[model samples]
Target: MSRADAYHKMLMSVSHFQHNIALILEAKALEASRSSQWLCHHLSAAQFGQNHGEQVKRSVEIHDHVLDVIDGLTKMEQALAKNMQALLGEPEAPDSGSLGDMLPLGGN
Candidate 1:
């Protein structure tokens, strides 16, 4: 396969991953929100002497994992940008525009 073709395939794969990860992140956020609400309701009802630490810990762990995923995604995007710049033989200016804008028109 040509270099452009390979790059396009990689871009598509990353796009798919980003979409799937977004859905997963949304679900996780909802789960954490529900857990928080449940804990709040129970606490307000004067329920005491129960260990709520586990739920709080789980929420924190989820948040930390989400942050890690975000960091990885950011790095992936940066690497893709560098690869694109190299493939195009032009250094892309920061904040110039989307990668689509840099791609050649009419299948050059």
Candidate 2:
């Protein structure tokens, strides 16, 4: 495959990885919110029987880890884009409010 084709494929793979991580983060946040609500309800009703706090804590940890992964991935993607541009001898293009600008990490 040509260098440009290979770069495009790699970019797509990274974009997919980011998308999946975002999905996981969304799910974890939802779980944490529900757990918190459940814990609050139990506490208000004076029925603190189950350990919902642990579940909430775990969910929060997962959410945080996902966020960290996203941050690192973003940095790596930016670096990769820069390196690829240098390798391809391409000049930086103006934004022009393209679709990529609307998507996260300049996804197409």
Candidate 3:
């Protein structure tokens, strides 16, 4: 494909990735809030329950990890989008840059 075509396709891919990451981030935020509320409501019970301490800790940790992952993805998506914008003028480097091997538009 031509350089212009590749650039346009990469832009489209970045836009799609941005939308997907936004939705995922929203979902993660909602889940984190819900889990936080649940923990607040059952803090005492979870801490003192006969056999729920570990479960509570694990559940909270899972939610926290999810939030971390969401944040990482958000940052990655933003960086990729910026690169995409830069490539608008440069038509991106293919078959050379390390990212070209992993990104959708980078595949040959």
Give per-residue CA lDDT, model 1, range 53-85, as digits (tens).
Answer: 765776688689879977987787677667766
Sorted by TM-score (best first), the order is 3, 1, 2
Off by over 4 Å in 1: 44-108
Best by TM-score: 3
Estimate every model's Cα lDDT from 0 to 1. 0.71, 0.69, 0.73
The candidate with the higher TM-score, 2 or 3, is: 3
Where does candidate 2 stray beyond 4 Å? 44-108
Model 3 TM-score relative to the real fold: 0.53
Best by lDDT: 3
For 1-108, candidate 2 gives per-residue lDDT tens digits of: 997798789778767876886787798679879977986677542343367786677668867976897798678767766766676677565553442344555422
Models ranked on lDDT: 3, 1, 2
Worst 10 residues of 1 by lDDT: 99-108
Clashing pairs in 3: none
